[model samples]
Target: MNAVVFGAVLCAGVAAWVLCARDEAVRRARTLLVGPWGPPGPGCGVPGLRRLDVRVQALLEPFRVRFGWRLGRELLCLPAGLVLSVAAHSAVPAVLAAGAVPLVGRWLRGRESRALAEERALAAGALCSAVAGDLRAGLAPQGALAGALLREGWPGRPALADAALPLLAAARFGGDVPAALRTAARLDGAQGLAGVAACWQVAVDGGAGLADGLDRIAAALRSERDQREDLRTQLAAPRSTVLMLALLPLFGLVLGAGLGADPVGTLLRTPFGLGCLAAGGLLEWAGLAWTARIVRTAEAS
Candidate 1:
């Protein structure tokens, strides 16, 4: 009976999650296509879903600063963990799982930020190269920068666009282009823009060769990008090792089940099993955290 109920609840939860996720995606897609904040589409326009989204968003508002706009999605783990605890007939694991969700979300957000920085870094290099070409073709510095940014041949245009907005505005309005570049440089992966700003400042102040300086900066960024790619390849081994180790607990459960043992019932109903589960989970979390820190340290260096 418990198994049947758990199965039904899980099915319902999965269905709801899928439908909600699809609606959100569709709404976002439509909004993008319309080139503005268009009306919500289909399921998203339903009051129940709309209110559910708003209420969930409100609940997660306090966490918005740390997690950005994705806190609501992370909070879904709470109900998921609850459903799992129901199946396991355990509240302790559920509580721990809920608590870990935010930390896990934070870790994921950091990884995403790092990846975005890499994209922006590559985009910055492309922008600099294009700007140099435009300048050599006799375009004004502002025109060169604008044309380079507006081009659609690059992979990281969205990231580049976000980082270059201030620079673009300054160029268009004649509002201290070097200062704008410096502001854009504050974004992750946009450190190259600082060099570009320095070159611009020199050109503006002393008539130094801006094109030549930009070319050098672009070359340096490309070299750094290539080195990062090589380093990532080297780092993949440790990442894969950590992932496999993390899955060992699940593998153990599968093996136990294959041996005709009631592992789930044993873990959920017995005190000794619960204690072991708690200890093992804590150690697993610690191991992952420690390995992640080491990888981040290596990446930073």
Candidate 2:
């Protein structure tokens, strides 16, 4: 009777999932957020998969705006949890997975954000170096900035793209270049803009060597990037340890099954086993979350 009830529940969940796949409301929302076609995907040639991907992204756009990128992506766990519940023939593991999704996404999100920040820092250094080179090549300060900004893409530093319009207007139309740089500095990973602003101001006011100041700023940014990279490398061992500890229970289950213990059956079918499973899952989750919080706090500081 229990098995039959579980089967019925799983079937209902799957049917709902399928209905959602072709829902007009979902499609309408996707269209409203992402437009008629979708955002440009790679030339991967998988149109159907790519379309679905874009639609999810469209739906999650608000989540992304409201929260950050990490939670927005992690919110997919609501449906993913249902899928897991359906697959496992039990709800315990699915509930555990749903609860653990944030902890799961945290390390990955931190790594991605750190890498992007490092790239942005490197790009900032490159920008400063380019401007310095142009300055030494007989261009005025404004002309040097203009030449630097004209370089395509800005290379892994899309955040800097925000500054382009204001910087251009200032450079070309006698607006306050230093002020623009300072404003741009307010962006994450672009704090070097503040240094550039100070340099520009000193050069304009005190007749200091702008090229020399810019070269120093570029070198400092590069050094900061290297320091961050080294720090991440040092932290890798602890990250691996934490991740391994989190997966140890799965290893234990595999070992038990190899030793002829029906661990899976016990956990799924027995009340006491289910309680232990829930308790163990929560402990694992809390441990991961706590460690992740510490790591993030350290990184922030």
Candidate 3:
């Protein structure tokens, strides 16, 4: 009798979920067709819910760009938490899992920032080489810069190309090329371009050989890139150690289960076990955060 009731309840829940999803889809379609100001839409009846939805979308925008399909994994946290809550008949694990979503998003953002920095470094080096080659070929500074912009397959090509627009404009109009370069350097993933701007200013103002200056800059950038690579290599062992330590608890849990200890049951059914789980999770999070901070500091230096 209990099994029949449970099955019926599960079927009912699934049916309701499907209905709700269908309704949401239809409402979204209507809103898209009619526009925001058309008629009242889903969540429009509740101002607070609407505001909260907006805030969540804003928060997720950056993560969506960085993680792509991986961002969907974060949304699974809520449902996974609910499943654990049902399986263990406890809410604690569910809440903890749900709370982890933000942390995961933050980690993804950090990875994106690091990648952008590396790309910018590469772009700076490529720009230096291109400019130096152009100068050697007897191209004017403006022509050299334009040619570099047209060159393909560089790490930060998109950003450099955008920066090149204002730069080319300045060069053509006999405006301040140095100032334009500095302005472009302020864009995201273009910080390294400031050095290029400085080199250009010195070459132009001090009557130095621009090609030689660019060559020197390219060499320095290449050396810096090598140093960064070495630093990452040195940090790999510590990162692996931290990851292995974090997984040790899972191994212990699995080992207990294999020994017929019903570790999962105990964790979900007993207050003491639940407390241990939460405490362990908190410690794991803290340790990961600390290790990450140390690594970031090393990278920044």
Candidate 4:
């Protein structure tokens, strides 16, 4: 009698689930057959789903601009969540790993920002050389700048052009060139423009030689770029060492498996093994963070 009652309850639950699923499918089909189709209406059934969707979109805006729409938050978190879930056979660690996706995105953005800075620095040097050459060839300041902008294969051209547009307009209208340049210097990824602005200001205000000033600035920028390259070469060994050390745990895991131990299963299934895994992950993260911080500080200097 007890077995019959249990079977009946199971069958009832399954039937209810099937009915709900069928109703949902029919509702979706009706929506599709009707006009103005997209996701179901905002008012349709699921509690908090709309709010959660809005929140996620809001969070993804910056990342979408940096890393594409498809490759933003979902790409970063989903694989990480899956890997953690598979490794641990648990949801809690997977959620925690997924939560770290933003940090990974932030780090990638930082690297991109630094690379952009370096590119802008190189482009500023090239611009200074080109403008100085044009000025020395008897062109006016406006013509020199315009000619430089026309040059092909100029690094950071898009960003520089965007920043220089206001300056170009001001120059054509006999307006304040220094003020426009200062504004350009305030733009994102245009920090190198500050040096150009300072050179322009001094030449205009003190009746100094703008061409000579630009030439000196170009030389100094090239020197700084060389120094930065040297610094990167010096830091390469240490960075490699840190990366190798981070991989040591993976090596150990592989070695343990080769020795006939069920290392992965032990780590995933046992509380003590989970504790060690978490601790090691934290240490590795800390080490990587410290290395990155040091490298960034050196680059800034």
In lDDT terms, which candidate is top? 1
Q: In angstroms, how far off is 273's CA in candidate 3?
A: 0.9
Q: Please, what are the lDDT tens digits per residue for candidate 1 over residues 2-105?
A: 55246436645654653443224323333343344333333434576666765665566666556655664456666767777776676764786689677756
- Please give the range of 10 consecutive residues that has the lowest summed lDDT in model 2: 18-27
TM-score of 3: 0.71
TM-score of each: 0.77, 0.72, 0.71, 0.69
Q: Which lDDT tens digits does candidate 2 get at residues 1-301?
A: 3443354355445434332332223334444543454322123454564466457667766765687552433445566566545655677656765875775457446544554455557767888999999988899889889778767344113334566668878998989999999997876677898999999999999999999999999989888878777877978999999989987887786687678777766887799888888788789879987997887787666
Per-residue lDDT, model 3, residue 248, is 89
RMSD of each: 6.4, 7.6, 11.4, 15.0
Which candidate, 2 or 3, has the higher TM-score?
2
Q: Worst lDDT window (10 residues) for model 3?
A: 18-27
The collision pairs in model 4 are none
lDDT order, best first, reads 1, 2, 3, 4
Q: Model 3: per-residue lDDT, tens digit, 51-152?
A: 544455556657756876334224545665676567656686578768877765465455545555666678778888998998999999987876775573
For 82-119, candidate 4 gives per-residue lDDT tens digits of 54465546665467656766775565455445654665
Q: How many pairs of residues collide in each model? A: 0, 0, 0, 0
